[model samples]
Target: MTEPQCPLHEGAPRNHVLEDQCIRKGPRRGMIVASSKIYKDGSAEVKDRLKDGFAFEKRSCMHCVDPGCVSVCPVTAMRRDPKTGIVTHHPDACIGCRNCTFGCPYNVPQYDFNNTWGGIKKCQMCNQPGVERIDKGLITGCAEACPTGATLFGTRTALLEEARRRMKLQPGDVYKYPMGDVSKPDRWHEKAVPVYHKHIWGEKEAGGTNVMHIGAIPAELLGMPPLGERSAASISETVQHSIYSYMALPAVALAGLSIVIQRNRSQQDDNEGGQS
Candidate 1:
C-alpha cells in the first residue's frame, strides 16, 4: 500500500529518522508541517560572513495544559495523562467526529484521509501501545536520532530551565549543548551560541504547553500562531458549566418534547372523532 507522503517534506531540511521512525512506521500518519525560508544576499559583508542559509521552524502538538481537544472530545477519546500531562488519543474510543481537529489551536490533530479505515492521527509522544518509548524510559525517535542535538527530550521543568539558560548566553559564546535526553544526555556538543528571541513560544500561550520552543527568530515568522495567555478551553468550559448547571438545558428540552407530543395526540383524537 502506498502511504500518504507529507507534501511539505520535500523542500524543507529533513530531520534524521523523523520521517522514518516517528511518522511512517509509527501510529501517526499526520503531516507535521515545518515552515522554512531560504536566504540569499549580494552585499560584501553578507557574502564574506555567511554562506547560503535557510531558517526552519518545526512544530508538533503543543499539548496544552488546558487542552481544547480533550475538552471538546465528547466520547473522551482524547485524554491527557494526569501525571505526565501528555495528551493521547484512543482510536477504539474515537467516533471519527473530527472535533479535536478544530479544537486544537496549533492544528496538530489530523484525519488520515488516505487510509481505508481512516482515523485521527497526531503525535502521542510515542507512548501508545506497541510503541511505548516514553513508558520504556527511552527518548522519542526524533530526539534519539538527531545528529546535531537539535531535538532534546526531558521533563517540562528541566527543559524550561535549559531554555532559560540558552536565552542568557552571549551570541558568540561556546556552550555545551546536550544531545538526546536533557537530564541524562548521551553527550554534549559545544558550539557558539546564536542570537535568541526573548520569549518562549509555548509559555503562557493559551494557558501554556508541555512542548515549549525557544528560537533565534520570532515565532510568528516561523508560523507559530499568536495566542492569548487565558486558555480558550478554560473559558468555554466555564460558560458551558454555568449554562448546563443542575441539568437545566436537558430538563428544558425534555419538557418541550413532552408538551409537543401531548398536543399532537390531542389533535389526532379530535380528527378521529370528526371523521367518525
Candidate 2:
C-alpha cells in the first residue's frame, strides 16, 4: 500500500481542501490556516534549496490554559470549558470589540472584515452549540480527514504521552504512529522516525495550551512567538481583580457620573431663572 502524502507540503491540494471544509462547516466563513514553510529540496529544477527539505505546521488558536482572548473580552463571549478545556466563542454575547484578536498571543482569533455583521472567527474544536462534534463523540473534520495521522485528536494526557514516546524514538527507526484519535486510534501509520527538535511547542508556552505541536522544525521558524511560561492572561486577570475588587472602580465611576449630571441640572436651572 502506498503511503499517504504529507498534507503540509507546498502545493498540497489536501490542505486547501481541508481549509475549505473548515470554512464551510465553521460558524463563519473563515479557515484554520495551517502555516507551511518552504525549504529547498535536493532537486536540480529548484536550485539554491537546502538539502534538508521542507517543513510545515498547522496554526490556530492554542486554546490556552488561561487564554488572553477570554481574559480581554468585555462581554463573556469567549469561554473555556472547565471539563474539556475547549475554548468557545459565543456570537450573541460578542460586542465585536476585536479584543480577542489583539489579546491573543498566537494571533488566532480573527474578525471577519468581509461580512458587516460577522463576529469573531476561531477554532472551537467543533464543540460549539450547533456543531457539538465532541458531545456527539465525533472528531474534528481535520483530524478525521488526516490520512497520514498528521493531526491526531485525543485527550491532553493521552496526546502528551504519545508525544513523549515520539520524542524518545531514534531517527530512522520504524514506529507505528497512531491515526485519528490518540487514545483509540482507527489505525497506525508505520513510518521511520525523523529527527525531532527536543522542545515541544505548547507544553509550557503562555502557561500551556490544549492544542499542541510536535514537528522536526523549530517552533519559532513555524511562526510561533517567543513566549515565557507565565500566561499574559494570569497577569491581566490579577490586575483586573485588584482594581475591580468589590466593584470599587464601577462604583467610583457611577458616583462621578451622578455628580456631573447634578451639576448640569443646576446650571440649566440658573440659566432658566435668569431668562425669566
Candidate 3:
C-alpha cells in the first residue's frame, strides 16, 4: 500500500483562502485577479497558507491609543496625525536614536542598517507623497493586496464595530466580508464565516489600536504575544511629565540654595579678615 502523503506536500497549487472564490468579484467589474501569484511567503513553503490565500491567523500593529514610539522619539520624528490618528514618521527630523525600537511593543519598525547613513523604515500606511492611497480615498497597499479582507482600513470606530459583529457570528454562517479597505470597499468577499476566537486582538491591548484583526487561531499563535493595558510609551511619558511638570519649581529651589551658600561664604570672609 502507498503511504499517505501530507496535505501540505500534495502541493495543492495554493488553496483559495479569500472569502470569495468567484473570479468576478471585484470593483473592476470583471474577473477577480491578483497581480502576482505569491503575495508573501514564510521561510517554509508548506507551513502556512501559500501566497494566493489568507491565513487562519491575522496580526497587525497594536496602534496603541497611547503609543510608545510617539513618546520616545527625541526629535519628534514620530507623531500621530490628528485627522486620521495614524502614526506618521518624519525621516528628516530623525536623529537615529532608535529609541522607538525599544519602546514599540509590536516591533513593527524596521531599521536601515545597510545604509551608510542609517535610518528607520516602517509602515506609514501608504501616506507618503505619490503613494498617498488613503489620502486619495483609496486603500493601503497591504489592504489592496489582501484579497481576503483580512487587512482592513477604516475609521477606528467602524473597524471596532465590524470586529465586534464578526465575533458574534456563529461558525458556518454566510456573511458578507468587506475587502480592500473599509473606507472604500473596492472589492468584496462573501463566504461562510470561520469560527473566531472570542477576543479581538487589538481592541484593548495597550489601550487599543486603530488597525484591528479577527482570526480563528489565538493571537499568540499568529506571532502576537499577550500584553498588558499599560503601554510602554504611556508609562515613560507619565514619568517624564511628572518630573518636569513646572520649570518654576526647579528654578525656585535652585535660587534658595544659592542664596544660603553665598551668605555663609560672606560671613566666613569677614571673620577671617577681622582675626588677621
Considering every candidate listed, which one attains the maximal lDDT? 2
**Local accuracy of candidate 1 as per-residue lDDT tens digits, 129-236:** 677778888777656766656677899899899899999999889999999899999898898787777898888899999988876656665556789998889999
Q: Could you tell me every candidate's TM-score relative to the true structure?
A: 0.73, 0.74, 0.72
Among residues 3 or more apart in sequence or in different chains, the pairs in candidate 3 whose N, CA or C atoms overlap within 3 Å are: 23-32
Weakest lDDT window of 10 consecutive positions for candidate 1: 1-10
Answer with 2 or 3, whichever has the higher TM-score.
2
Per-residue error for 19 in candidate 1, Å, reads 8.7
- All models: lDDT? 0.71, 0.72, 0.62
Order the candidates by lDDT, highest first.
Answer: 2, 1, 3
For model 2, residues 131-194, the per-residue Cα lDDT tens digits are 7888899887667767678788999888889899999999889999898899999899898887
**Candidate 3, 223: how far from true, in Å?**
1.6
Q: Extract clashing residue pairs from model 2.
A: 40-49
Q: What is candidate 3's local distance difference test score?
A: 0.62
Using lDDT as the yardstick, the better of models 1 and 2 is 2
**What's the TM for model 2?**
0.74
